[model samples]
Target: MKDMVELSRRELIKIITILNLGTTLEWYDFIIASTAAAIVWPQVFFPSSNPASALLLSFTVFALGFVARPVGSILFGHFGDKLGRKTSLIWTLLTMALGSLGVGLTPSYIQIGILAPILLTIFRLLQGLGIGGEWGGAATMATEFVSNKRYRGFWVSWIQQGLQFGVILANIVFYALLGLMPRLEFFEFGWRIAFYVAFVIAVIAAIIRYKIAETPLFTKLSSEGQVLRVPFIEMMRRDWKRVLIMTGIFLQASAGFYIAISFSEAYIAKFLGFSDSFAVQTVILGAIATIFGTMLASFLSDLIGSRRKIMIISPVGVILFSIPFFLLLNSKDPVLVTLAVIGYYFIELFGWSVMPTFYAEWMPTQYRYTATAFAINLATPLSGGLAPIIMASILQTFRGNYLIAWPYLALVSIAYGIISAISVALARSDTAAKKIE
Candidate 1:
């Protein structure tokens, strides 16, 4: 393995770009599923006597992907930690593309009856598996390859941006299609086109990902016979507390994000009585804020010499802003609602931006891929996966009164804030002790 000194600045930039592109495609598919579940799928795949029941069913299937993610983390995490990042990433991309294409091409429930939704569930599970492993591999590859420790946060921030960019692209595509076609037409055929586009994006991402070299850290570990035979088990035995702490920290961010992106759109359009176009526009604006906020937070984390500060502050921001966000949505005015969406996302994305670097820096290289994947993916089902379902259930229970949902989200954010502060403090103490040794 060549030292970091051997890798050029240009090479590092290329690696970051390639890995970011792969995740961009991965999240593009995700946003498509999320968008569909919120709007299109209820009408098409899960048609029922009750409208609320249909939406809940769609969200349930959406959460099923989260249920499968931990399995993906363990399965691909093994190969990722034991084999190579590049190889694992290429396969994850392929699986994601295939799953998306399958969803795009499947017949509607009206045409195929029960078979249609069954197939959709299967494909979504495949996507869950693909993305489960993709994040850790891409994050590890980008962070470990960088020679300068100071700029590591900045580079990993680009990977986070991929998710925001994917949301942007997905919203833009939906916005354009909705603008071009009538509502009936969009529901009939236009939605499928988004998935087809995801497949193409995945192919491009896979090609770029395939061209990148393995990280120097992984190479060094493998060469020195330091790679764990079972990275997930080793992580469990040695770093379970770290894993639990990371998962707890991640849960708040994941739940807050889904509530902002996934649940808000449905709440605005259906419960708040806004148009579908207005809802899509709100999400697009929020995605833009998220991109800007992520970059700003990443840059500031480096400048301030602590990702912990950003992590701790983010959930508190979410908790404080939760009421205003719902109040703006309740206004039913497009402008205020837009402000609400963007304002919450700007703060929420700060935690998202710092997570890649935090996870990468904390875990040892031998089990970094498995540990990071397990921590994040395990949290996904608990927090991100259930957030929309929980919100939807709350709405259902209250007979569509959104006022109750706000407090639930606020409490979750507050818990995340407290846990994150404690975790960050402990991590810093551990780092200081290691340095003293």
Candidate 2:
């Protein structure tokens, strides 16, 4: 138990990497749907007289996944707290895997009629449930495994980076598949295979997750008879502010991400009329930058001792760059298009790369799962789910111009960034770690 409190660097990296990988896999499954929807979902699952309405129908079903997230948090959070991080994670990954696979295998609207969309919505709900528990468990695993008080800023951020990795993997696979096949073929058959691939990722992620020992932090807590009887109630009574603050912080990150990925997918593939592979390649290049950007943000946070700074400044920088990036996107040359995608990727990672460190630090060891899950799950899916749809609607109804939508994303990023900065400062100044309680 004493040793559990002070983990070694080797053990810390091992646990952190596993935590990162699991979430990476989960996010890959999660993110692929958004990309698929932007390109394929409308044509396959939803039928409408107009392209705008069809896209809306697709995004509406996408949003359905978000609405069910809180329910997943409640159900899985209960099991994660009462059971253990290890056991709960295995279940969570498998759930997401199955759901993702179902989506990939689903018969299109042409064949299934209403059943296609109905089945699609059901699978997305399953994904929301799996992800609901994934972040809290992953965050707790990384933070709790650390030895030195200071290392939390560095390694905990790795968990967040895992998300970037998942996104990277998803983008690479999607575009690579698109590239290998013709656009006509991709829209026809290739998209379904992407969903099928999740089954493989899930099996591997589950095996890796199962091989790891239960986190020492949670095991010690449980062995000492300190496990909460009701983790959600404990979170509400003890540290609701952390939930609220982290939620705000997550809003910036999630919105930035969805704009870069979700909305951006539609922007590039649907709007720009780029080849499906080219669109995926654009996203993949950005993912390449994120791998570096996210780790760099985390590493810098360790040196600076302030994650709030990274969260606030990087997003604003992204907002400033939005115009230039959009202009490059318009150039339409593959080289310039790739650069624009990469640039946006860097902007989006700014918020995501740093938030895990800050968010994971917000809770005490006892209630980390509940607090982190509630903040992040709600923040992400709501923002991630809505941003693309709203952007689509605006483009359809008001702005005939696509790049004009940058202001909308930029404004949301700034608002969330301001709120996050204020909250972190308040938390840092408080002397009692238990102030939230």
Candidate 3:
């Protein structure tokens, strides 16, 4: 395999662009469902339930995708590690496109009765499986292409930025649709247009991915015959503790992000008495902040010379601002709500921006694909997948007092901060142990 130093600037740029496009498509499709779950899916699929119950049910089905993500991680991780990154990524993209197409064409309960939600759930599961594998592959491909180790964080952050861009794009489309169409028409057909658009983007991304070569690190490992026959099993037996640490590290960021982006829209519209358009606009502002925050955090990580310190400190800030975040939202002003969301995401960027580079460096190149996918997918169900439902339940239990949800959010952030601190200590001890040996 060629070293990163051997690759030309053009080749590096090409690789990053291709991989970022794939992640952007994946997140675009996923965010469509998330946006719909909060704004439209309940009306279409769960009309029989009360508004809160219907939204909860929609989010529950949304979580089903996260439930299937670990399986996807293992399935694609196997081929990604043994076969190749490009090959596995192509397949993941195709799978996600299929799910997006299915979702776009699915009829509402009013049209097809109970079968509507069943199909929606099935397609959501397919999407979960695809995205479960997409992140690890994209992150690996981007970071491994970097010639200078110092800039790995900056390069890999493009993948995270792709996700934020998808959120921005999704909200822009929704915002435009809401502005153009009447409420009934927007609810009935406008949302499905976003899914169709996502499917088309996914296909284009898959074609781009297919043309790219495998990463140099994976090629090097494969050529050396260092690849494991059963990478997942090996990861489980040899590096399970690392997997646990990764899961812990991601929990709060994942949950906090979904709550801030997905659940906040519904909370604002339904609980806070804001318009749906205002809620969508708020997310767009937040996503814009997230993109800037990711780039800034990545640049700072390189300058600071420690990803772990940034990750640990970011969550502490989130904990400190949790109450204030809710208070800003409670102001019920669109501008304040937008500012609150942007502030929250800026803090979130600290951990998230460094994750791709951190995970790539933490795992062995031989089974990095499988291990990273498995750990992240496992954490998703616990955090991002359940975030909406958890928040909804909290709102319901507390009788729509948005402020009451702050403690839960704060507790999660504190736990993430503690876990990150412990992980850093464990990593230092492991390094010392290796030196002693």
Candidate 4:
């Protein structure tokens, strides 16, 4: 308890690198399913619906994971705080492994009837629960373990970029499998293989995570018995506004971003008539954009102390670019689609890359994981879980008219982003923030 040890740059990088790799693998599982749903689930689970409606149903089941995320945050954050950071993260990865293998092995609706979608939903919920807790634990570890100590935002931002890294990996592997398989074979078996592959990735993530010790900050807190009795309750009672700000940021960032990334492949393939390979490739490019844009935005946030500033700009870009984005996709030309996805990549960067820092910065040392987990998770059910279903519903009713759907999406993004900007402008810390008034 009396030790005053200093962490070296090498040691800090070592910890951050492992955490980032594990976080990327976690996202790899999530994106694999989203991409799989866009490819296979509509036929497997909801064969009775029209293609559009079936896709909608598929994403709805997919959203089940997002729905389960906050519950995971509450439960895991409690134990992570009360027990230890390392322990919570290790188990979260294992939970994801079970869910992934479950999805990979589940019988289709044709075989199991209604039980198929039900079991699929349960697996996705478990997946979401694991991810829900994983984000804050990983971010706190990255931010608090660093040696430079000045650019917590940048380092945390780098960890944030791991989501895109996972997306890129998922996209590449899925795209390659699709390329190798015939269309019929691909739809029948390729998708399931991707889900199964997560078992291996999860094992790798666990191995890396196990080698890394607990965050020094958490170690310090443990010795002092500083863990919260009830982190979510304390944050809700004490720093409710940050929760609101995070909710708003996620509402803006997640819904629109999901529409752009998660929904884009099927949207383009079905509505715009692109080939499967092109659609998958478009997602890959956008992921690449996200990988780079995330780090760039995080670097800027570190310099500016304006995490909200980055999020606020993304929606504005969406509103201004929505028409062009739609137009770019509609042409079905690869170059134009790439251009559209590139625009989306930057949009995701602007909104998402800053979120880790923004949410983490909103709370102080005492309740960082708790506040960050709760605040950031509001996006799951509202924004993350619902975006694909909402977008599918919008297109189903409007029949894929951007005139109707994009404006509505843009409006939602605008309201959320503006409010987020206001909150960021007002919030200097939990105690001094004017937006709480």
Candidate 5:
């Protein structure tokens, strides 16, 4: 598994930096929007007589971003495979920049009536489109740049690690704002600052990406005239099963991760009556723990020489913890709630570090970006995008019965984890040390 082009230490470092920055910006923008939906947008853009209705509408808009992701994936994934990763990445970053900037500048409902929500939805969709293709390009670039097949999971994982940093960074910003301003002020104007920060991150990431070269594997494909005209169609015709399996393998994380980080914030602060600062603080702690957990898992995946084994085993943790996680959250005890949040985020996603490398290795050079992005994005809207709305609906449906509601919620997560485990186990392949197909 020799590298097509060997990178010097400095060049490799720069490549990794740009990849991580692009992904970090992607998730940072996503997290801030989630946070805003939970605490800000319902009040600002979707004002209503009934608070719950307003919150649900805001969550719907947030989910719209996830809905637009697959479309983004298809659009940019096409260019990524046919043209170059660098070009696709630059556009994705700028698209996200425009989205975040629009969100930051858009007027509130009081100022602009229905147009506020309409503009907000448009911006959110743009954010989704940008992120839909961002992870695939970043992950593919990282995979192609490095040569050592043995620890490729560990290296590409740095791009995924941006998710943890994004969570931490977003929560920290929100925590600081909540601490400094009154709750009323935060709802009024403080939330806009977070989206502005996202705009800045996109600008920086786009500049770095524009300066970098395309991945060596893609360059080689281009030079040899092997690039596919329609990578998505080619992938579906030949590797559809693999795509489906990969989508299933991602379901556990797709559902549980968003439930814990994005939905739980609203659940904790709005429903459970925790303070905004407390909710943000808990997320920051959980995100910090996840950084270490995922890094350890990456190291283990490489050490074991089987990403599939790690993938198959990790979902069991999610299945086992699903019930307990909700039980802990329902306790209304700060200590228990904090522990539950941390464990929910950490345990279910222990195998996440292997995803980028695993997905990339399964596809041929020409189809890698389109296949990987399509698979992940398909799973995203199915579970990750709708998770908050679903979880909230369950809670509202069984309004007075905490016991029944919590377990019902847990059942949904358990189902996803079980599906993920079975999917990975069914995919009988060992590509850990093999060259990319």
Candidate 6:
């Protein structure tokens, strides 16, 4: 083993900025689409005789994006591992940008008949494909850039911060639009502005990404002729168990986040009698809490020198608090709802904050991007993608019974948490801090 090249403070900041921007840009587009699905898309693209049916249809489209993620993950992860993270990242950002642009330019169902929903679905899938590749490369870049292995958690947490920031931006933009325009006007045209803004963010992130250099580890591997011809196949053959374990570990974060941020919006608006703006506001607050909480959790992981411990602890806390979170939401008191939102977001970060570095540490440099992306993306479709649809189906099945619906969602989260905790506990992987090869 040789010493990893140390980046200067300036260079490290530049790298973090580039990765953070790309992550934020990708997620902004993704989350904006999700927010619209909850509030705006039902009327614009998937209008129906029954409002519930329309909402469900819209959520189906929303879930389709997640379904496309694993495909994106495989496609991008292969290139990320075989080529260079920098190049793969730049392309992913552009793909997401184009998807957002398409969504923005797409006409409403009133104008285009069935073609409107179909175009929306296509654009959303493109966004998913772009995001699938974006996260793993960003995480790999962030983790591999930092010189001190011990602080990788704190450093890579910034990339996760971009996830929260993206949520915040999405909610804030939607909230502002809700306030600025009447409900009809907002639904008609204001929503497109958010997607348009997403395109600009992607373009800016891409330009910034082009200026940054590739991770030193990947560069070293490439220089030494260690790049695999087929990184995904190689990883599956050797690290299949670890991959499965990681998928389980990621389940809670995937399901928990979408449920918290997206499904909860629909629940609050439709069943609880809150305004869409109110739901977006709560999510904005939750995202902010996640940003702060994840930062703290990442720092603690580095301080305690154990990423797995936080991962285990975080899910247990989320499980215990799951009922309380919904209870608070059901209370219908704005203060309690906000508190519940923030609290759930805060507790979950104990696992998510450390996830990037934790996943990166488990894989060798030659294929880290593919393995991490594949694991996370696999969980996305199974958990994140299904989360909103499942919750919506539950509520619909019960004819919009709040009491049954809330508890049921909480129980589902508990199940996901248990699976995540048990998987991490049982898995055999290198969780210790180590220099990247």
How accurate locally, in lDDT, is each candidate? 0.82, 0.74, 0.82, 0.74, 0.85, 0.86
Residues 1-437, candidate 4, lDDT per residue (tens digit)?
32213766677777788888878888899988888788778887889547778888999999888878888888877777778777888888988988999998888887889998999999999898888888887876665565235666677776777787888888888889878988787766677887788888897788778887776667787778887787777878888876776676667677666666678888777777777678888878887877777777877766775666666677667667766777677677879988998786677457677677656655655677776776667676787677678778877787656556665645554554565456455554432111210
Candidate scoring better on lDDT of 1 and 2: 1
Off by more than 4 A, model 5: 1-5, 400-403
* 252-371: candidate 5 lDDT, tens digit per residue: 888888888877888788778898789888889998998888788788888888888877766899889988898899899999999999998888778777888889888888988888
Off by over 4 Å in 3: 401-437
- Model 4 worst lDDT window (10 residues): 428-437
Total clashing pairs in model 4 = 0
TM-score, predicted candidate 4 vs. hidden true structure: 0.92
Candidate with more favorable, higher lDDT: 3 or 5 = 5
Which of 2 and 4 is the better model by lDDT?
Answer: 4
TM-score of each predicted structure versus truth:
0.95, 0.90, 0.94, 0.92, 0.96, 0.97
Off by over 4 Å in 6: 1-6, 147-149
- Pitting candidate 1 against candidate 3, the one with the higher TM-score is 1
Clashes of each: 0, 0, 0, 0, 0, 0
**Between 4 and 6, whose lDDT is larger?**
6
Candidate 2 displacement at residue 358 in angstroms: 2.1
* Sliding window of 10 residues with minimal summed lDDT for model 3: 428-437
- Winner on lDDT (3 vs 4): 3
Ranking by lDDT: 6, 5, 1, 3, 4, 2
All candidates: CA RMSD in angstroms? 2.3, 3.0, 2.8, 3.3, 1.8, 1.7
Could you tell me the lDDT of residue 41 within candidate 1?
91
Q: Give the TM-score (vs. native) of candidate 3.
A: 0.94
